[model samples]
Target: MSEKQYLLDKTLETWKGKRVALAVSSEHSFTGIIEDFDEEVILLRDVVDIAGNKAKALIVKIDDLNWIMLL
Candidate 1:
């Protein structure tokens, strides 16, 4: 695996079952408990969004992510 992939895998391991917020773009962000992930996307459960509403789940593309904050 590439170095970036290695680090992403490691970070994913730590993020599992933890509350995290992903910055996708200047206007979009997703916050929730990390449920699962693959090479392409992340599945989040019980997402707490910016508008302060709760969502059952959220799927975010990895390539779209700018940053992730553990909350």
Candidate 2:
């Protein structure tokens, strides 16, 4: 598979039943439990420090994300 596809697959594989620290563009950060994911983005809960205060509903696109550190 292509590298991008591989990375996305890895992200999804690592996301299951795990917490992650998502570093996005604009120097924003998000730490939460990954609820679900797709090829383009991820669904996160307990989101904070992005759009506003802490929120349980958030969708972070993969292109906007710089990195994801599995925790």
Candidate 3:
């Protein structure tokens, strides 16, 4: 794999099962426990989102994220 992808995967592996907040854009975001991930998307459990949204499970695209903060 590419170095960038390797680093990303390593970071994600370390952060799995931890709580995180992901910013999709200036107007949207989600907070949850990182459940799992593959090459394409991440699975979030117990998701509670900004903008009055919530879900038991969320599958979000990796490319759609602006930033992630550990919580």
TM-score of 3: 0.89
TM-scores for the candidates: 0.92, 0.76, 0.89
Find the 10 residues in a row with the least total lDDT in model 3: 22-31
Q: By lDDT, rank the candidates, best first.
A: 1, 3, 2
Per residue, candidate 1 scores C-alpha lDDT tens digits across 19-61 of 9988886678779999999989999999987889999999998
Top lDDT: which candidate number? Answer: 1
Model 1: how far residue 55 lies from native, Å: 0.6
Could you tell me the lDDT of residue 43 within candidate 1? 94
**lDDT tens digits, residues 1-71, model 2?**
88979977886777776778888895988888888887888888877765667887679888898888887
Q: What lDDT score belongs to each candidate, Candidate 1 first?
A: 0.90, 0.81, 0.88
Question: Whose TM-score is higher: candidate 2's or candidate 3's?
Answer: 3
TM-score of predicted model 1? 0.92
lDDT per residue for candidate 3 within 1-71, as digits (tens), equals: 88987987899999999999998756679899999998789899999988668789999888888898889
In candidate 2, which residue pairs get closer than 3 Å at backbone N, Cα or C atoms, i.e. clash?
Answer: none
Candidate 1 wrongly placed segments (more than 4 Å)? none
